[model samples]
Target: MTINETLIEKKFSNDLTEAELLEFKKLYETDDAFKQEVDFLKNVQRVSETEDDALFRNQLATYETEISPKKVFLNSKWIKPFSAIAAIFIITISISLFMNKDINNDSLFSSYFEPSKNVSAPIVRSEKDEHLTNRAFIAYSEADYQQATSLFQKAFEQTGNSELLLYEGNALLAMDKVTEAIEVFKTHLTYSDALTNRTHWYLALAYVKSDQLDKAKQELTIYIDSEEKFKKTEAKSLLKKLK
Candidate 1:
């Protein structure tokens, strides 16, 4: 039997060998084409549970009109007529659900949440120049998020620099402390600083990560409507996914 067939058979029977499990994980992670093929197979497997024959036929027909001459392949074999129709039907349903589902909040967050760079302070300060801001940014750059957040808060208190709140929030986000990150971003936005628009974008991402879809959409809309050109394209894409 083929490797894939063996894996599928064993997986369904709850008896995948350790070596097979390791092989499956390696292929899924390192091989993009193989991962996509596996995902397609999984989605097609779900098609068997679909009971609406009329809806399936209608969707399949619609997809057939859209890409009529293109051949569909499954399990390395060519299929036609109802078999091809089933493949296309599953693909259409998959696309439809992807565009409409709110269950992708975690995925959308992962896809779009990039940490803002350390524009607050340079990491190359003199050894004796031990300013709190520099130390905080150094901690952040080194991925010491717990120390970074604390130092950012302290530096903000001492210097009255609202920008530190932005990094503090970013540090919290890096730690996956979504609720703390949301509050920090919200607080940072209250100041009339240059980071206000950027904070809105980050805040929207925080809301999305927290599964607060309505707040995420609202913050995203605000960010999209702003003049901050940095993440506008990504914000628009994320907003569309939320819808």
Candidate 2:
């Protein structure tokens, strides 16, 4: 379509060179309308392209939210960190799983695991899409975890809000930043019981992603016993796999 859209597609597709990435960032920094257009495209492309991104994005907001420019700029603070997240790959393992009785954890994890898609319920405070909260929801719904995390954090900062903290954590987990996600969820748990069951289920999945099987099983046990029917079937299946 447009030159900006082409550049953004290249950036997300990991086809941009060092020089192009730098120049693109320059455009991103100076052009607000361009940024929003690019974000809207990203929302469309990411969701329509894969079940993985769509599932994760849905996990960000339990309800619908909108996007805007100022909030998008607040989110731009995280674009650099996303370079790291995008660079990640499951490195090819040379070890033999059957012969040596050892398998690559990455391969093992990939075989049966996907991030839990559960999301915190939307607390529709303020006017619809008024500020950081709605922007954060929009980012997450678009699978823009990098921006979503930043917006969620900024939202939390504005009000000392714990529910936004839950969103930040969920966004991180979706990004596969498991360790950081764990702490955020734990903090949210301490501050509020609003989404206790959802938190437990997601926390358990975080442990699974991080290879903390024992801890995951423990959390899953708590979730299962708590009668959180929302994910009981999925939880039982995952728990059985863990055992």
Candidate 3:
């Protein structure tokens, strides 16, 4: 059926089947002009359906008496001026109301209007021992591996904390500096106590990155035997993958 006929039938009919609605949706997707005409008809039908009968009858009478072709002010020069005056009055009232709104300077509204401050928590530089560790973590989170490595190096100079060394090693690994990462991890292992299960796993990963499969397997063995069940499980999986 033609688009116009389909739209008229949908508008006047009370009970369109599901199939007819689907067909109308398909037509709307494929034809923009058909969709516009359908939308206009739907809006007209909605206004007629919701209009108060008394108000509509009064409006019809007014239209016949004062707005008919013979009686209407079609050529009056004052019509444009009256419309312009009405528009200006509406705009002025809108601006006045908008400007006179009760602004709460002391409330949360002031926070939105004020410029934001850089109130981020200061970088935790508590001690020489923790300074590099904290800075490395911040740099890693910010995806600044080079800065993290430099900070990690400075931290290691003052306090050779295995954890800080591991951070440096991990940063090197992230930068694809595998040989440097391997050296850092190995240095940590030389001084690290037997309780350092996490370090062993990370060292194993560094070894894998360096293509030292045998060393990676040996480190994974130490990691898998540790009491930390989670790290041991992860190490076992890596060992299986290496094999």
Model 1 stretches astray by more than 4 angstroms: 1-103
Model 3 earns a TM-score of 0.44
Q: Could you give the C-alpha RMSD of every candidate to the true structure, in order shown?
A: 14.5, 24.8, 23.4
Ranking by lDDT: 1, 2, 3
Per-residue lDDT tens digits for candidate 2, residues 58-81, read 433222224433333212222433
Models 1 onward score TM values of 0.58, 0.51, 0.44
Per-residue lDDT, model 1, residue 49, is 44
**Clashing pairs in model 1, backbone N/Cα/C closer than 3 A:** none
Q: Rank the candidates by TM-score, best first.
A: 1, 2, 3
Candidate 3 residue-wise lDDT at 143? 65
Per-residue lDDT tens digits for candidate 1, residues 1-243, read 568656654554457899998887887888888688767656555554443455555565566557853532222121223444466766899998876554577678888887799876668657897788998988888889999999999999999999889889999998999999999999998998878789989999999887788999999899999999979999999888878
TM-score of candidate 2 to 2 decimals? 0.51
Show the lowest summed lDDT stretch of 10 residues, model 3: 112-121
Q: Candidate 1 or 3, higher lDDT? A: 1
Question: What clash count does candidate 2 reach?
Answer: 0
Model 2 scores a C-alpha lDDT of 0.66
Tell me which of candidates 2 and 3 scores higher on lDDT. 2
